[model samples]
Target: MTKRNTKAKQLILNLLKAAKSALSQDILQAQLGDAVDRVTIYRVLNSFLEDGVVHKIVGDDGKQYFACCKNCSDKKYQHNHFHFRCISCGKIECLPNEVEVKLPKAYRTLNFNGVVSGYCSNC
Candidate 1:
């Protein structure tokens, strides 16, 4: 399925695609220049998140960052990937490989929460 393109959405999408890694709102705004506003950015982020066109990488600094989907044509992000955070520089990098999360056979009946965070080589 394909989505109808809008100017603001395209701008936000391009910003994510060009980012080195996950980008904070300030960085995105700076990168986007005067083309959009914070509210618009927030809305676009939320919409993209719902549509799976982007993914959020929460940083230890208590800020949410965003990354682009490499396969953007699919309108969905592969959920099995991991994101690496640099402790010293506070940069977030997406792991090239997928990380599998499987519950134990005995615990499969229970609901669980999972999140993985750690320092990367850049730290």
Candidate 2:
């Protein structure tokens, strides 16, 4: 299904595109202020996820974070990269390198979400 280009969606997309690291819903809500409602933001985020415009990452703190997808589509999602979380700053970022894991002969890999937590370079 085709989704409309609403102002709230555009704002959320712009914020995700401009973010250097993955952002949580709370963070996005705080950044958006009174312009967008929480329910609207949740709906837009779900739409983005369905459209493959963004990918979700689980933070070390157990919070769900969203980041812009570089090479993803509605059918296929190529997210073999690892996510890094800064212990000092509590920031989550998707690393550029693709992760390669060798599985057993009969094992088939589906979705992978690897998180590495440590002090970021800035810390």
Candidate 3:
């Protein structure tokens, strides 16, 4: 029972890789119906997070979004990326981890989340 043999996991990984943006469990379940149970999707996502195969972030809407982590390993995401949330369609995209935003000294920062909201190119 090696993890590599799990069909559901492979399906999820492929789905995330093909996605242009992060995906929620709701959306994942919709894309993969009868083949994989809804509960399995959630479990696989959790496992991926723990295994550092994918990264999860809480969106501005307070919902969890999962995206594949090609740049992550050993339980840490080596790159820092931003989330572009489209206000028009409510679609959130994971941008490349290259943009750096300097925070002002006056603002005490605890956690940094670069989530910018605006209309996407498709909109």
Best by TM-score: 2
For candidate 3, the per-residue lDDT at 3 reads 66
Sort by TM-score, top down from the best: 2, 3, 1
Number of the candidate with higher TM-score, 1 or 2:
2
In order of appearance, the predictions have TM-scores of 0.72, 0.88, 0.78
Q: In candidate 2, what are the lDDT values of residues 1-123, reduced to their tens digit?
A: 666899999999999999999998999999999999999999999888778899889877898899999867545756788999999998899998997888889997767888999999999
Residue 102 of model 1: what lDDT?
72
Instruction: List candidate 3 stretches off by more than 4 Å.
Output: 1-4, 98-112
**TM accuracy, model 2:** 0.88
Q: Estimate candidate 3's alpha-carbon lDDT, on a 0 to 1 scale.
A: 0.80
Q: Give the lowest summed-lDDT range of ten residues in model 3.
A: 71-80
lDDT value for candidate 1? 0.74
| Candidate 3 residue-wise lDDT at 17 | 91
- Cα lDDT tens digits, model 3, 1-123, are 556649998999899999988899988989998889988999999998778777876788888888888756555334367888888887887786665557787864444466888889989
Ten residues in sequence with the least summed lDDT for candidate 1: 107-116
Q: Write the per-residue lDDT of candidate 1 for residues 1-123, one digit (tens) a residue.
A: 786678989988987888788888888889888898998899889888878787777766678888876665665334566676776676787777765667677653221112346665665
